[model samples]
Target: MNSGVFITFEGPDGAGKTTILSMVANHFKEAMVTREPGGIDIAEQIRKVILNKENTAMDPRTEALLYAAARRQHLIEKVKPALEEGKMVLCDRFVDSSLAYQGYARDLGIDEVWSINQFAIEMLMPQLTIYFDIEPELGLKRINKNKEREINRLDLENLEFHQKVRDGYYLLMERFPDRIARIDASGTVEEVYEQTVKMIKDKLAK
Candidate 1:
């Protein structure tokens, strides 16, 4: 069986990852493009709860668990099946989001958060993860300028929290440099997309 290649895209909010993914999807027509927190029906419901602006009352651990729950359902229902069929699975976000947003930014300890995810994912990890690196200030500014972008609970967080999320991603980069490819996201959409496509091509060539 041709167990397919799994790739995930990650970055702080408003880094244009979703937009880039949509464009990338156009280029790779055969690839299955999806996003975490919401890929399948069950997970989409969880995504609504986790991202609702009214969910400001949610505790850190609760948020983490919710994301994990969504990830589990999405993985079982979508990701694994695509990979088993030898398709290129391109996900917008994965465990890295939890590790950054909840684990590091929320001060829940990466190892601790990882322990729970270990159960949820059962060690299923993407072969490649593209991380769009950006400054929190610029990212948040982009969010504010984009009126159409969903204003979620995480988007409302203070700059400090977002910075922590970026820092957390940096730590992860250090931890898994080989699997996680970092791309500067401060440029225009075309530039970022070009860099991303090059990275993907390089990985595919390997």
Candidate 2:
């Protein structure tokens, strides 16, 4: 039997989550560093379809379900096996993104989206989640500067929707304070990294 810890990074687009996740994973890259819905081969293909900008006609529910489906495949093909082998699984984004973006931001209702996701993962949840906190406007500004970033179906959402996503994450933080830690992402990268490192050190120590 494997005994490993599962950690996830979460934040709105352009919140520097991917950068932080990369550093965190490097600290233990010998284990595993993965991302949702596309960490594995098959799931990556689904990721392309889901994030394609041409799919402008995609329904909200369809978007949510696609994310869930991709998550399921990633969990089965990558996350689970890593955990079962006692590898450190550091993932960039996970179920919380769905809860915040698709569930609340998309106005799908957290409970409703969660119910659908339950079928996808069989209730497997991340042991620890680091929420990178930043204002929606600032995050969007950052995203816009990165031309290479995928501005797809979800990225086209309005400011109001992004705000709702931030609010939704705050709600989850309050509801699951024990499992989710908030880090101020507005700070300098070094400052943010130090705070995150401290938080992880504390969690691991416990």
Candidate 3:
């Protein structure tokens, strides 16, 4: 059995997941906050290749595999070790991202994507997942407003693709309702943060 609590944050780009996670991290003194595709050195390198805007020719299967690879490295090098030490781990994105972005949105089967992730991480799964729900249009607008953030290849996808990504998340919620919590992401940062903190605290209490 795992010795620590593992929680993951999921959302469409600009759904305020990163910001809210940062604020919530401050509340948990023993919590470790990390993001996928680049939580460690090897994974960070793979992240660059996956997100590079110039790689427009990358295959969907190839993209999915790379993400799984990075996730495996991150788990081995950082996440599992921290969890073994009994730290609360708050991950920015995890296998759910592949299920959404690559599986449903890209027309690859969700089960297919999940199979690969399972091979990568074994049976390890988050105890709780906070999904920031928002309309794709609004989420894209939020992303565009952030001038300092790098525009990755996924950010360049058309609006329809992002909508499908959101739909995919909804489907995953149905599949794992007990594990995923939905929070409205259309409010101010403080409002969203408050909701997130409450959900997390409630989960911990249980």
Candidate 4:
């Protein structure tokens, strides 16, 4: 049987990861697509509790642990099973988001957040990570244009926080150069999708 492949898409807001992931999922017949704090029933419930707008007073550690809990459940119930059966899993976000959003941006420290995630994921790292490159200012601009969307609390963080997230991602890239690929996302949807599709095909061919 072919070894299962785990690929993740990650970036700051407005990098069009959703759009690109959707397109790639449709094209890949064997792909099991999912997003963080979701993908399974239990995880989805956790996602609702954590993401609810009313929980403005939620503690940072509480939030970080919740994200990890959701991830653990999702990986156990959905991701690992698919991988065992040799299915390609295309995750929209993974542990990196935690290291960036909660660890770095929330001032939790990457090491602390990663320690928790280590327990959650047990080192089930993605085989490939596609990092969408977009400037912080442009990303926030995209959020501004989408007024209908109920913004998450993380979105309310200041530019400094977002910049820290970006820097964290860069640090992650440095740490995993062979596994991560940076793609310029500030292009036409067609352009970005085409490049991403080609990369996935190339990797699968290997």
lDDT of each: 0.94, 0.86, 0.94, 0.89
Model 3 alpha-carbon miss at residue 40, Å: 0.3
Lowest-scoring 10 consecutive residues by lDDT in candidate 1?
1-10
- lDDT, model 1: 0.94
- Which candidate model has the greater lDDT, 2 or 4? 4
Of 1 and 4, the candidate ahead on lDDT is 1
Candidate 1: where is the Cα deviation over 4 Å? none
**lDDT, candidate 3, 1-206, per-residue tens:** 56999999999998989989888999887899999989999999999999999999999999999999999999989999988998899999999999999999999999999999999999799999999999999989988999987789999999999999999999999999999999999999999999998998899899
lDDT (10s digit) by residue, model 1, range 1-206? 43999999999998999999999999999999999889999999999999999878899999999999999999888999999999999999999999999999999999989988999998999989999989999999999999998899999999999999999999999999999999999999999999998999999999
Q: If both were scored by lDDT, which would come out higher, candidate 2 or candidate 3?
A: 3
Q: How much is the lDDT of residue 1 in candidate 1?
A: 40
TM-score of 4: 0.94
Off by over 4 Å in 2: none
In terms of lDDT, model 2 sits at 0.86
